[model samples]
Target: MNLTQNRTRIIEVLIGILATQLIVFGLAIYMFNEPTRIVEAQGEILNVQLDDAMTLYAQNCSVCHGLAGEGIGATPALDSDALRTMDYNDLEKVIARGRFNTAMPAWSKEDGGPLSDYQISELVALIQSGDWIETQDRVVNLGLAPLIPFTTDPNPALLAEIGNLPDGATLQAAVQLFAANCVACHGADGLGTGIAPAVNDPLVREKTADELNRTVTLGSPGTLMAGWANVLTTEDINALVTLIQRWDEVPAGILPAPNVPIPVTEESLALGGQLFSQNCSRCHGPEGQGTQRAPALNVKSFLTDTSDLAIQQIVTQGVPGTAMPAWGDRMTESDIQAIVGFVRQWEPTAPEVATPTRGGGGGPPWLRNNTTTTQGTGQQSTTGQGQGQGQGQGQGQAAQTTTQPNWWEIIDWRILLLAIGALSIAFTLIFMGVESLKARARPAPTEDKSQE
Candidate 1:
């Protein structure tokens, strides 16, 4: 009886162990690789409907993104992983909202864009269908990219308004004014932007105050800078010149000026250089070489002039046009002095400056004067003359600085034209679309009541 019972127990135990092992094996396979199960269950893990997404993209997204997802003229290429892996919501937002600084217009409704909700969703869905595996072929990581800087739509007259500074105080004042208004685009360092010229370049330094003033007061036609005569005051124009002189002190990174010149005993040119880089590099080229449109400095006529009162006055007041602006409110006297001292240190890049044409169409008597500040002298400086030798009379070389031209009138017209164009296009498209939709919806008269 015991043997029979033992055999039966052994058999049952073996059967139980085998059954358990099979169940565990099955469970492990299911958890580890559930693709087969999903196929059988009529559901998938990742919901990437490749076919539907491809169709949606071909119909709508190819216009700007290109049929192959290639970007067109102003459009950035979407063949980047950064674009691929960006959060879906963020992609949707960017597509819907056109960037203010770029040509990427808002395609979705949130940013006053044109895409509908279904279209927006479909766009997102289609893009996701593409392979998200970031191929090492293109390495620009979109996740780590920074937002592009704000473009300066500065007034050309304002830039020209920066006068030839003879005194440290006047120069400092001008720099301060520029910092408040022009630095955002010109770069606080005076380094130029794609559209604006470098303010602190050695070449610009050679320009006579009159030339500088004329450039500032009159907006250059066909240039990115708008005129500023209407926006600024007489006091404002003088202040801008003082600011440009500050570029003389910009350090190595922002501009290539010596900064805190050897003679400026008030503040160390070292300190001035720091201040220049931080506050002036935006418009001035890095290392002081003016950018695309910015006029260069590194000249002698600006700070080495023999006049003072006039230069200081110029620094105190801003010229009429260009991006140069008034700075009387932001800076203290000591700061202005420091800037002037820094400018006095810079070496000129050119010997002679070309006379700048004055802007404005008969606005003020002051703007009409085309003569350089003579400091009572009638002779104009040649390119080879000793311009940097700091003249030390009461007012300084600034007094002889030249008169600026008028530049505000032209800018006013341009702004008006731009506004008109925007309004015209927006309204026209809206009206046309509305009319077409209305035409489509009109129903034909029918005998519906007698249909029975």
Candidate 2:
């Protein structure tokens, strides 16, 4: 072929390659703009157990792909047709090998991936039931399900046990006080660390008054988290419920969403219920009773005591200076109202809603866990895998064999795969275009002049 022909061919290939990009982007754009699909309230997808797969997705997938399989411009939808049409194994393959020529890269151990086959399989299985198609309300209705259903026997064991014991101040007041004074050391946000321990830690929130009392009375030495018994008043001591309730700020924290709105009528409540179960249920209990990591809503401390409007604000703004990050960007106003409605039903007798007791020269009943079995004294101890104390802290600090809870790891891999896949697709287009041009440029093999 002549040089002209080669150039012509190259131009055509380049055009085709560019067209492919337009096509991919066209399809991809729809996904970027569309909202995430929500699942049924009782659907296994959201209402299901927090297995290894779910955990992985939450940590990794939720970042760009979204918490409910919704995709952002950076990532594709995990629940919609883009993902649903693909078989579980196919998805697994994509995750493991990644789409070459695109940004998505292989994530398998064999392909330099982090997860094992088992973990991958678990992630795929969870995605199998993609109930993520349900449309979530920008707002939610806590009332759809009774905050505290009336039972014949009415065992308020969990509530009564943590309820009384003294703080008479308003829950909101405590929230302000703690935010102003305590957050600096205990993490103005609640997920404490380094200088401070995890004040908003799931287990720490559940400790009884006696436990808090003990920790508050005594001080944990060595650790920066000092005892604060002498400085604050008795009233301040009791305001901790506000802090305890907020401990559960995960999914980046569940205050409420802006796009999500509350549905008032039965229809709205039903809709809100559907939305909440899909997105909120993972952290808040399927029963809305509160998870180890999240606080329950129906409790008066966060409910009856505060106006519905305040709840809406919480949903939107999130408790600043707490683990509760804002969700306003996630939902619509209506959806936020609906979630408020949902919380109205979540009255767990009155939530103590106290913040974590920080600034302590003393260890209160709240900080029972600060001490390990090795020391009779109440001091901070880091136990990684429940493998006895003494050396526990040492090993944890050294290696942290502890993985990022399966779910978080999987999500991270998925993001890496998507990024690599995109890059691969881009390079593939350029390479194919270049090769076509090169092929066209080669002139027909010169006749053997020797024969002439």
Candidate 3:
């Protein structure tokens, strides 16, 4: 009878323990599982979108706008107070339609560019995110100037009088013309600025008035100097030349020429390629194919007509009254020569020519289109054979379509640790309950009283 009662007592205790566990498990599910699952799922989706956006930006936008959204040559900075304060819809429209008569191209696929609607939204989200906004705020507050100065439009009033200047124009008129049109690139005194070379340089002064006239009239092709023949009359061009020649009397320091001549070797060519990609590719296309902002260097006509000395001069002493900045201040003479060596390889008669990679260089691999070709028998193939090959190709293509698993597929380590801890606690309580029940069921040490 006592055994029967003890068995019932143990069963009841075990049931109560299980009931407590059930209640605790219910509470844990309510607290940690339901609410958190929704939030974690949403977070994973957001993270994936953000990653996609960053990749797209690097592939498409970074070339002109910089890797960090700071603008390059002639490109306005995206991460600025102006952009931050802009309405989201307006920003989206700019990315979709682009600015008129500017270097900024429409990026949306619908508008004839590569990106999709969803991708555009992701870029917008990225731009408006707190991190990017904070970066812009910091950059602005720091008052640091951009490496490449922004290009501004010449005054309309001044541009209208381009070909209408009077004969024997005075120095004051020339000064006003320089200030109104060329001051942004060339300095106020016609000395070099961040943008262009000094007009007072000895090499420039040495050029005869006729050579200067031709230069000013026809402009330098493949560089930023636009021909003033259409814009200025012959008299105006002559006056401009006269004013530039007068600078020779000022006795300013002359810019140095390259001490080390560039050697055209394989190693130099490779280094030149790297340097061009880092510096020139942003404005000029990756293979010098050209963009709306810069002229193509690889064109047959340009390569054929341009001379090595001319190329070297342009690289060293940038053209005045243009967006081309004087690179001599920033790069060593040897480095510039190395770049020149690389550029010369694109000449029309060169042994080998380079082709621009689609989407240009430094873009994501997925953006590149893969072309595959198959070999077949010279005789016409049977329909059955063709169908079989098509099926095999389809299967191979399907296999290639598999993508990497997203963050949501992976379990969180923190959640796993918490589950492990909870399980350990539950096991400990079960063991303790069993021990208590065993103690209750075990007979007391009454046998020790028999010894007494």
Query: Which lDDT values do the candidates have, in the order given?
Result: 0.42, 0.46, 0.53
Model 1, span 115-156: residue lDDT tens: 576666656654654432221100111000001122222343
Locate the minimum summed-lDDT window of 10 residues in model 1. Answer: 137-146
Question: Candidate 1: where are CA atoms >4 Å away?
Answer: 35-48, 85-87, 101-105, 109-122, 125-452
Prediction 2 TM-score vs. true: 0.24
Evaluate model 3: give its TM-score: 0.33
lDDT score for residue 30 of model 2: 45
What TM-score, over all chains together, does every model reach?
0.25, 0.24, 0.33
User: What is the Cα-based lDDT of residue 20 in candidate 2?
Assistant: 76
Residue 363 error for model 2, in Å? 33
Question: How would you encode candidate 3's per-residue C-alpha lDDT over 206-316 as one tens digit per residue?
Answer: 899999888777655423344566556687677678767765442222121212223353433554666677688777766676555676666667666666545766987
Query: By TM-score, who's the top model here?
Result: 3
Ranking by TM-score: 3, 1, 2
Name the better of 1 and 2 by lDDT.
Answer: 2
> Which of 1 and 3 is the better model by lDDT?
3
Error of 1 at 79 (Å): 2.2
